[model samples]
Target: MTVATRLQSMQPTDIGVPGPTPGDMARAFRSVRRDPLTFLEQVTAHYGDRVSFPVPGAPALLVNDPDEVRHVLQVSARNWNKKTVQYGALARVTGQGLLASAEPSWIEHRRTAAPAFHHQRLEAVSDEVRAAADTALAAGLAGLVPGTGRVVDVAALTHRVGLDAVGRALFSADLTGHAQQLLDATSDAAELVVRLGRSVMPTARWAPSPTNVRLRLTRRRLDAITAQLVAERRSHGRAGSGAAYGDDLLGLLLDSGLTDVEVRDELVTMVIAGHETVAAALTWTLMLLAEHPDAQERARAELAGLPAPVSMLDHRDRLPWTRAVIDEALRLYPPAWAISRRSIGPDSLGGTDVPEGTLAIISPWVVHRRADLWPDPLAFRPERFLDPGAGRSGYLPFGLGPRLCIGREFAIGEMAVVLDRLLTTHRVAVPDGWRRPRPQAQVAVHPEGGMPLLLTRLRAERRD
Candidate 1:
């Protein structure tokens, strides 16, 4: 039988499901505001793995099973579309960018943009990534007070580092001048999206209000900046060489015959997706390392053996422990916590019937931490990734299939370079009584209060 037909054949009772009551819906909404991860866990706890929640005028299914998530995101991708609520906010900032656009358009855009992230292309930019990381680390360490030894906010430092890397690599420009402004804009846009997401009902695009106005303004500001950069590149020809800018991401996008609006959307998507996730992953990695000095020392030892002027691309495969640390961090705190999709046709996932127009919610936050899948789900253990026999399905920091992040390699390379440089030069330690910050699930899972740490330059002997 066809997937849709099979879905129709199953009765609601047979699916072991019931409509979310009014009280349940109210509580669910409240939990979404206060703590979305907890809210999802509560739903799963109360209603089992394949539960349907009342989404006002729409049908929504929260799928926690790894197999089901894989099927929705990969196998039967054609049967799904990005929920308007999620993409509506993204569309405001991105304007039909690959991330926000659905189906054929998104596919075309991805195809056009894929070459820029090809292995050969990214290898050429590895030096830029390492240089940006070095610049960020040097600045961070220089800011350290002399005697008192003030604590550094590692999360903040890493965000700056990640932004610097993306700026230098993607546009071949320094973002230091506009970093704070861009960050503010991105953060504000994320908040506005979350607020707008909760309030927006599906298929109510025509209904207009203040939120719409703010979204438009935010989009305009972001686009205006991106447009200026593109215009500058067009006028300048190429950086120094003036030879038409070979294979950088910007050049590739320009050569793809995309309109200015389309280019801006992709740029915005890359900046946000590429930088934010790397920064968060780096922050969490350092935080975890700080709590485990042995792991920190081992990672440092790995870095010590690296040749001078190390490029993450060259050393990523060589440094097994370093890669494992990043994996563990992602497992604990995936920046892209929840991925949502709207079903275009009826389907049965994990044996539950989902009708057309249903919202399928796949949360890495829940799946990675499920006690059944991960032993001591809350513990910080990088070694789990090193186990050759370990199941990989439950771990998806960059996602899977055709829609997987194109910048995955770039992110890994950048992180490895930064960590190698930082750990080799300084000892990062958390201040006593410094509580780990709760993750604010906005656009990415970033520490709300910033990750604070004490950085002490390693003595020559200590380095050995």
Candidate 2:
């Protein structure tokens, strides 16, 4: 052991500060049930960055400083795991997949899944995403009521596009017809699991409550669909005389020798995370664009100049402004709002002693909004990313360290594809007196209301 190890070996010290008592915890829970977003803000304001909350079980700490967050999530990440109440509940849906697993298992699965996200594989799928955008957009526009000037449910539209893109790119299947029904079930499941995690007396999943019953049904349907998809892929593999199957993500997982059960877990995890977060990000991006017409015009001008039937991945280097706009949108509304961890061993953070089994919360929502780290943190400015190192540590839309999202590249590529499609085709605008959406904090920070927007199709691109 080195001298640095000696510091960790020293006897653990108690956190020297005061925190919320049981009564305070009770009060916060009330707010959490009522309005979780506001509850978190109130907690931070009352307790400051390095806060501790004492409850019936282990204590909880909320760390906001970037350095401290790095310490928890990176420097000493090995000593922490996803055994917290939040993640335990999340596992109800995700099972032991990458998001909910720890140690050697997570390491093994990450290694298995890593190659699927390779730039080459993503490049192959980029065309599928491009196709998805075209189809989804044309359908949405065509479905508009006759004589209506492009009123749209932007939230639902983005979701449909995201679902279609992920389906084609990952499974090579069309999740077109039953996708929304499945998506609705999965979403309900997400809300239930999150509520269970936060509840002090979180009813056992097997409990007979209506939410629990719905969650059970939802899980069964999701499992059946994923199982069917995997079975179909396996049949394709068998039919090819044990030849190399297709190179979709499901193919990659099968190739890596993951069992059907393992494949199902990973697929469902992707469906939940990929489908919801991308849609939320796109919804917010369109909303932000509507609020800032100047940025929209600039992006459209850039997009209008691109060749028809554009391939974003092929010409990504030439679309800095468009990428910057998406980046800025992510900064303002990170989908994975709060990251929670449970300390396994004793450690000190920011000179404060953190005991074992402490619930460690690092919120990207709060961190991205810190005024000191980001000048006018609430403002929409895509230029921040135009500068190198803007995203190094302070920006955490994707997060940091070993557990960083393996799908980061995939998410960015998909977002770029959708953004290019929408900006090139239409100008999104809000209705008169449309109030800005309130950021709702759950597993992700998403808009409170399903965003409604007026879309005006851009003029035909000038042929060169």
Candidate 3:
């Protein structure tokens, strides 16, 4: 028999976990392909927290129980590695960078990259964010009457600001000149990654199919940008630090004695992950605010009477309500919706026997929406976060455990700065008869068809 035929016959029936039959899955294949989120939610809800799947060869389990998720991501993290199909696709683009790297080496990589994101260093990120935000506002939304709202694509605006901020803060380089080129390449790369994830039969990266060819070109363009960045940094000669490179992430990577190819991989990884994730967060936050004007106004009020031109760190604790709104947005629409891992060894999770090589998928999208974990899970209530104890468990927006996102603070601060600044000068509201955008789960949960919102410039007196 063929490989597919042999594997299909070897489906696990005694895993001590419940899941849809292969026939049921076959019937829902189209729906699953079109909208994985809905399918996942429905399956989890139907099968309870820990559900197995009818995949051949390797067993697949969706771990939705909070404790099971914690066990996989935190308690038994070492037993799980990023060797699954989800991260495998990411590794194709990012190579073995921190985001997609497995353990042992990833430990060293994290140590090497830590200093660059030190508390003091990241404080400077607010300045970069403010500068980028100001530039984006001037270029994208310059002419606007207070009441006569203009239809604006805030998603694109967030992408610009996100790329600019990451470039400045981490690389100590301005990326405004290469923003469109880089964004287009990264966007294409993300689309390709999603397509790979959706495919029933995996395509080899070496195969010269149309998708593979496009991905090759996209990677080439990204490599070209990476080369430009490295060359410019070399020419500038450390920018007054007298070190071979400067005291930024690039410098740290260089000092770590990594090879040129290794450095390129990390740079590309940062360029994609650092910007795209935060941009999605920022864009989704804007969409949430636009849909709920009361919540938006409350958040804007918290921004008022703050120290003039406060830095990101300064605004961290001061804007509790605003921060609450952001927290809620992240819960509702986490950028990295699914975090997947492969079982490196035999382990029991949620009282289910998960064999070695099993795929354990933890979806923050589903976890965040669990009514048992979160009361009134569907409603957009920022007030829920006002309690200090809230979101201590079952919340993994930036993920949980040692593999938690290194740039969590950076992204959070950047979002706060952009949201604060935008709220100070303009009121964002959904246009009349505006339909909420269904999230398109790609590299991140992007709003379908883009987020077009109405922007009304606030009068100076209203700011007081």
- Maximum-TM-score candidate: 3
Write model 1 residue lDDT over 1-464, tens digit each, in one string.
54234333333322356545545565455567768877777778777777776444356778888889889888888888885577766776666777777747888888877877777767777778777777777677675433335588988889889888888888788888878877777777877767766552432445577766776777777877788889987886656654544477787788777888788889998888778889989999999998899999998988788765456565457888888888888889998888888888889887667678878878888888888888998999889878855658787787777778778888888888888778876888889897889888877788888899888776422221
Cα deviation in Å at residue 114, candidate 3?
1.4
Please write out the lDDT profile of model 3 over residues 321-365, one tens digit for every residue.
Answer: 888888999999999999998989999986667778988898999
Error of 1 at 9 (Å): 28
User: What is candidate 2's lDDT per residue for 178-292, written digit by digit as tens?
Assistant: 6877678677867877777766556666679986787788888889888888888877554456555567788878888888888888998888887788889888999999989
Name the candidate that leads on lDDT: 3
User: TM-score of model 3 relative to the true fold?
Assistant: 0.95
Q: What's the candidate order when arranged by decreasing TM-score?
A: 3, 2, 1
Give the least accurate 10-residue stretch of model 2, judged by summed lDDT.
3-12
For residue 16, model 1's alpha carbon misses the true position, in angstroms, by 4.0
Q: Assess each prediction's global lDDT (C-alpha) against the native.
A: 0.77, 0.77, 0.84
Clashes by residue pair, model 2: none
Error of 2 at 213 (Å): 1.7
Using lDDT as the measure, name the better of candidate 1 and candidate 3.
Answer: 3
Worst 10 residues of 1 by lDDT: 6-15
Tell me model 1's lDDT, rounded to 2 decimals: 0.77
